[model samples]
Target chain A: MSDSKAEASTVPSQKPVPKIKDISLMKAWKDSKAYREYTLFVQSLNRAVHGLKNSDTVPLSPTLDKLIILLNQLDSFIDQCPPKGRSRFGDAGYRDWHGKLEQESQQLLKDALPEQYHNYIEELNGYLCDSFGNSTRLDYGTGHELAFALFMLCLCKIEALTEQDSRAMVLKLFSRYIDLCRKLQRTYYLEPAGSKGQWCLDDYQFLPFLWGSSQLTDDGPIEPKQAIDERFYRDLSNDYLYLGAVKYINEVKTGPFFEHSSTLYDISNVAHWSKLNQGMVKMYHGEVLDKFPIAQHILFGNLISFDPVPKPTGEGLFKKPAPVANQ
Target chain B: MNENSSSNTNGDIDRWLEWIKDCKYLPETDFKQLCTIISDIFFEESNVQPIFSPVTICGDLHGQYYDVQELFRTGGYPPDTQYIFMGDFVDRGYYSLETLTQLLVFKAKWPDRITLLRGNHESRQVTQVYGFYDECMKKYGNANLWRFCCRLFDLMPIGALIDNEVLCIHGGLSPDIGTIDQMRIIERDQEIPHRGGFCDLMWSDPDDIDWWAISPRGAGWLFGEKPTSQFMHNNQLSLICRAHQLVQEGIKFMFDEHLVTVWSAPNYCYRCGNIAAILAFHTATNHETKLFNAVPDNQRVIPSKTTTPYFL
Candidate 1:
């Protein structure tokens, strides 16, 4: 093909090809436009989310101050790069510049106003899917990734709350996530695993199922074989024995059981041994505690609240209190 | 007057008042009540008065019971003079309950001689993370008793003015915290939250610089030396003695020897095999603080017999 024909084919029908200088000028103009728009959006969103009106912006909150420091650091790093207009591939440069601008803008929004940014990202992600069907698009992925990051930030905030608040928030978040998972008919990436190597059912899910079964049997009047599995029976017995030992030891201390670390260790040991015993009973035919004589020491350690206390039957051994006589 | 009968009547009245005052264990049980109890127990007779002699200060016994026993051997048991135990009686160690019990028993037995102030660990949050809450759950199957103990722990005084010289506490100086009374007025009613005023009070560490430094462990801010020195100077205290940091010799002096750290529990948890010690204070013409290693005799080494089944 002739050079003129190739040039003509490359040129668009509606617009004429520009000179290299004009192209560079045009690219600079485009980049500045994108940067201005992006920065304005980020700053406005940040101010709105943080409740920072003109008068209130003098001293930044600790969280906002940290974000500003991070943004300044990013700005300094970005300043080291060559301007987009100077590059040979002006279109590629523009695309790269736009991508960077979007990323930094999203990051700034996330750092400055996390919760609002997260909700915004989630909404943006949904809109991208519905409007463009562009799941494979970089912008779509970036939006979703931002949402995920925001979700993680929320988790961190929830974790950092006071214990009582954290507990309440955890239960609320867990329930909400579980409901979301059910609605989507898919497991959340954050779901904790169960013993059987499956995503653990939500507490709400398991409770209703267990309660339904019990109600069917009229509050568990069914035969043991039908009503309870061997594991259930074993765990029940273990809990009973361990809790009993704990109660007895607490009485011996005459103080809060937790006031001593040894007491907890003893209780944990009993719980562990009970689990081991349950395992052994399920696996072997004979009584594992008797066969492995050392196991007796495990129970004894837990009972006496000391390792190798002289004669396991000392005066300080945690003995069950005698029944109190009625007055 | 019948000298014997009159003296006996006065003694009985004092005893009656003392019993009434000692019955209240809460920290808010009135300073006057505490004064009455202390006066009845130690100051009634001039012979039993606590002299302005030297006494060592120690801090942060996080349930290292054996170490405390060792400390007694090393620092010399109280009653010869006086020893101030700067709180943190429970958590971290396997014997927090035992250690606290022993300390409480000792305090009860020797009311004026031993001083026990509350540390951050004595609060609910520190105990919860460091094993107090779970230990309570396992030991008692109820959390209320732990709650009560924590409340009691919170009511503990922040610092003790020893012979009007050394200031003792679990943590070091904070930029916001300028005086001992500020510490005393801290609402110790709740467990320390992760951040804010309560956390800053409990988690802040000392530094010897002009500005607050970031925490190396990412816990919280550490106050620089300038502020610490300022606080010490402003309070007119010569030395700021504190605990919390684990020192190699169980004690360390920082901030150009202006601050001293004394650890009473040696070989902390058998994991941190450091030499632990207590400070002995004697104020003569010049105040002299003596550091004594407080490791128990029995914990020096494990016995071969105990290691063998035959001993068992």
Candidate 2:
């Protein structure tokens, strides 16, 4: 899974991974406004992702440039170490690989974030560290991926990322993060944590399709049949986010497009990309955010607001608990 | 609802042997009959039923009909070998309706030999959310079959005990269920509740924590050594056998061998890279554990992409 695109000797500085900052020292994030901030965060990301519909020839931004370089460094980093444990499951080698990332995560975040936001690096390192994958389980899922998404949103919250950079973030950094995660999945053979089989949007990803679909919201009409033409998807991917994701889907899954990826298959048949994009967002909220097992392990820090909403204590106010996927 | 109900007097379940063995679907009529027969039998059993020794204990089929057949064949099929399945008979896999039909038929055919307890996925609402409800629609062209299966799940037991020595359940311990008898009066024949003991029995996982904590799964509580030890000791059982979490080796032992998790679906969802296992608890003789890997030749046919999504 080593990317030939990333050259050797691109390692970051030889410094050890930084210590975690005490987030408790920050003002209590559990205040009522925390949920509002969460809503605002999602709203901002929605606008940012939706904004990509108008972008075609915009010049690339600096934040995107730094993220691309960081991805390359991480890309080369994987090539340096060989996998250590069993062939398929329970690979001990991924532990060392992730540990190396953990050790360098603080440095990696510092290198990825713009210089103006460098001072907040200590506070932000915890989420950045959690964004990769769990070494103990040796798996990646929507949970870890959500961590990374929230990590990026934290960058935005701190003004490290801004509305101006949103379009480029999706086009470059977010897409690149998807690429890195894909490489990790294939190279390390990471398990799809609590996969719901083909019922899910994609085995290892949901954000790409969500953001990607938003990017295609204004692009006239899309037919489900168009998704079957792999070559067509590959040709159009460099220009469209949705096509890029479909291209990646084609690369990973086998069998028919409709068979292995029914959710996306259904999306293709929708009347318009705008409706498809809207549906994707709701699906994320329902299947990913609202689901307990995925949301349970999620840590609420200063940026994401570590507040637990007190349960409503009356009839008809029930939260649907997450069933163990695939039993 | 279907007005006519029949008892399991006809040995009609034996008729579906070829369909299940060939990995084919049961006719819708035969499926309704099977569901009716099993529901009648389960309606008589308590929430915490009793089982004798020398039975094969299996866990979490997860709609893997092929693995279900594999386990039965490996364990020396039917009346000769008693089988106890610890819930999760549907969802995720392609042949959920077909697989579940086999278990219902067997329970009807050999009422004394087969025991099927309800797992979390057995509920009507869960099936509607997961693949079973969709698979039934795709295969049978209606939700009638799905409705029958849900009715059967409502009547199913929540847990079972073998020779009063081992307690078997789908998930793990719950605070509400102390004596096995306590579960008896909590009500049955309704959809599983969203919270309380009924939900916990089907959702919780055993963790390494000291006391009961909120389960990450949210529906069930995460119990540590204290609760497990107390549960087994209070019940006067040597071990608590369960299935819910995916164990890479197919079975995992935690908390000083007092709690065992046996996952019977190998290569879960056809991609989990896991193996399946069954516990052979023979009290008449010595206790034994049997493990099996998923069939290497197992074939999965992808559901059609052209199928439109159904929003409920």
Candidate 3:
């Protein structure tokens, strides 16, 4: 996993790698270097953020603070582009905010990342720019969330962030990024991009629940169902991403939890957080990584190449047979 | 009416309707049968379905089953107050199976009283991307019902003409189709195409531009007032009624009253906070928009642990 450390001094390729050009390459995506690193990185962050709270102090990193400031700057732009008099969902004003992000993203990335990593700004900027939301669609979802994660992954590969920063990345930096995303969502009324509505975990995100569930591990005082209880959610939401998301849903939506968010409500029925966390990881792989609609938009490059990894002998024993060519 | 009612003699459609009325889905076998029955009914209908006056027009139910019940309540139950649901009956909401099943049962029971046009979301690809496919797997523990429903979707008519004047479709006009007769000639029994008249009819939206522009949705073109009015004039239509786009107001009249959008899923996605509306046409020249909000929580049946989809 630390092989990236060896390549830290090497400059990345000049041009960004081509995106998942077609959906047929989805099989290749599973075997890509990026997929391997992403799974490992997510697992590491999952372990790092375990039992953490928004209030709990973690090892401080200047790089994390810079990223937070960059997010803050973008959040302030929402004030600049207050939603136009509402027509319906996906306000036009979000386009303006996204436009601002697009224009200043390179500069913002330059400021946040250490000067040593400045050479990687070209590739880094695309992920950071797309991380906010789509300007044209005025929508956000796990695809954009994936972009932010990729940005952090780029940072990790470049050694701008290291193993030590994983905990701070999940607790401090990623938390701020989601906060900014929420502000943009509420302020601009960003639509959910390719949302499965009630079937999906949440409208705008998937990872926080994955990482958040890890925070709830070790048979804590709260059970899975209790996470949605107002008494527990209100008290623990700040401490746990999963509960905070439920609290947000409660605020924005008006209906029984089971009716509006049946998927999450059903998930709450699981007996333990560890089980839920493991399920979340598998789901992220199945639902997000494997789904063409999401995977098609992912940009593949040096840090996260689309090139396939060598399939280990007898690997087919554990995995389900690969799906036949898509119709 | 049609002879399809004879199939309901077995009382399965009625039983399914009763189950759906109570917010439950039909059993897997019954659901497959209903799909077979409804697909046959829709297959016999034309690409441009012919609708009568004194009908209520709706848009995009998106599977809000309780809101649909409220809609039936607001605008009298079908057959009493005939309906032309301009597509989008599934996806996004929790009760897609029930909402779609109830509508299908209504069509199967009273083919003459209700018209179900195809929306973009009706297609197999769209359902896979949206919630309906997952909902089927979650509820039935398999994708067979989803496959049956997708077949039914392919069989649905793409457009409806009310009194030969008001052309109602899930989306707006298509550049490939200048006349409703052109729409009539389409072979629509397959997944929606990426382009051409058939796809455009189910994916297009109206804008204030002069002519056709590329739609952001990727499949259809963004038709403006000029082409819309020209299409109406060419077809001698008085109004073009569509339902693909959400209007903050339940009903929106655009292009100087030449086009109208009727949305029927209130508080869409359980959080949009926008009311839904249905248009009741008293005559070719007259219609009323009936508005309704989302059903209260207590009014809707909450799903037990055994029913809802487990994230795993």
Candidate 4:
């Protein structure tokens, strides 16, 4: 990391590790190379997961298996740091578990990746550490989920995970990450930081809806309306990320599905999976990426630079909304 | 109670109340009319509207429409049991439109029976960030209803005084406002500003500190027992009742019972697994607490199987 100054002096054009200093620079972030790369990477993975089930056979690289193991090890820490008897919504004992994660995460990342990638651990660990919920607030949200996505993008940028591993990225590593997050949410009773209650998407994650909708695109079995049906989600959950998320919500929350989950209920009214997938991509940009509250916490580094890419002359800064079919 | 309280208006309000009791929202046109009718009633009230004893004081509703119904069932409905709702009527929960509409209709019908004080969430900025703005857009396909609601929120009273002894507000105290008279001088018919007495009254919280401290919420000050006691003593108030933060026990009294936070949204956001309560004052000093849980799934109406709205 100390070499950043020398490298910047030598290259003259390289941006120093990106840090989101304020909300005003968010427009520059939208025009940044990092933002483009991140979204492109996510769309690539989204395409890779199209028409695929979790159970379907796919090659898992050793790097992914080690990362999954790291998540598993972190999961086991929850048992050791069980929530103490407390009256508050967020348990205090989570601070202890988070403390443990902070202490061991760097070493854990070193073990998970090969020696060739050890140099990037300092930058990578920040994303990995923040991927879990906040220790102070004892809550998790789509912002933390964004950290994990950027972590994956960093892996791809560093070539630790090749283009061939894109399918396994969402199907395996990301799936395992979701499981760990759900466990943390339940065991620790993490609050939904800055949640819009039932009006927003699900309390914790939004990627599953994005990538999950992609899995259902075109030849996928279920339609948008049928996704909420218990008969479909119950059996297909293990096989589909979208159903798994839907099933998870149904388990925790009480009340009618449409009422408590009005946003998804409205989304359920969409006719086709492809249209839903397109809308979800748009939603992720509007809700998660463009939002100042969520984006403020995002870290820009050597891997994810904040320097904007120069636009072609006469191009509009704001692009028109992508047209949807059957609107 | 006022000149607008005609028999026809009462009948319309009664019908709206009945319709909302089923958890249905008034149409946009009807909702606009309700907001207009109630804004006029609210405009005539002072910043700290005077309320009588034997009224029920409740906390944040947060769009939990069913739990609000449960709250009424537990504490008795308005007119029978006068209510002073200390703000936070929308956001977080599923039915913001239905929930706020019911309270507004009740206020329109029996303006004298209920005191609807504004909460922090009532502001245009806060509601847009929260669920109320989105809920409005989703329900009506536009933000017109949300806009009308925000205008109504601006005109709503800030605090209520129970026989001039207990001060009921949405959030907590402001250092700039030491007396209740200062509150009255505030021109509160606009968006809540970034700072000042008006903003602090709705955004501030009570913390374990000595005097005024910067609040983590970024807008308000976190005043300790010293400020609380001083404000109460200055205003000759016996108690300060507010509802901005969540209380797992439904009601929490702090600083030796000088201030209390009554949270009426149970199992907040459908997951906190907390109880809700309301304080029923027989007199200004003596009150009974009624605790209630979230409305069970079976008790609430599940939507009937209907035709699919979308087709490929």
lDDT of 3 at A310: 53
- lDDT tens digits, residues B1-312, model 4? 565667667788888988997999998788888888998898899998999899999999999899998999999987898999999999888788898998999898789999999999999888876778887877788888888998899998999999999999998989899999999899999988989999999999998899998875678888999999988898899999999988999999999999999999998887677899999999999999899999888788765432222212
lDDT measured at residue A25 in model 1 versus the true structure, 0 to 100: 40
Local lDDT at A244 for model 3: 84
Candidate with maximal lDDT: 4
Residue lDDT tens for model 3, B94-190 = 8899999889889878989999998999988999988899988988889999998888888889888889888999988788888888888898899
Residue B250, model 1: lDDT of: 64
- lDDT string for model 4 (A128-187, tens) is 888988887788999999999999987876768866677888989999999999999988
DockQ of each: 0.01, 0.13, 0.62, 0.39
List the pairs of residues colliding in candidate 4: A18-A300
Tell me the tens digit of each residue's lDDT in model 1 across B116-139: 665667776556545666545534
- Going through the candidates in order, the fraction of native interface contacts each one reproduces equals 0.03, 0.15, 0.71, 0.44
For candidate 1, the iRMS in Å is 18.7
lDDT of 1 at A102: 48
lDDT of each: 0.41, 0.70, 0.83, 0.84
Alpha-carbon runs more than 4 Å astray in model 4: A1-26, A217-223, A313-327, B1-11, B208-216, B303-312
Q: What TM-score would each prediction reach against the true structure?
A: 0.43, 0.66, 0.95, 0.89
What C-alpha lDDT, on a 0 to 100 scale, does residue A322 get in candidate 3? 20
- In model 3, the Cα lDDT at residue A95 comes to 87
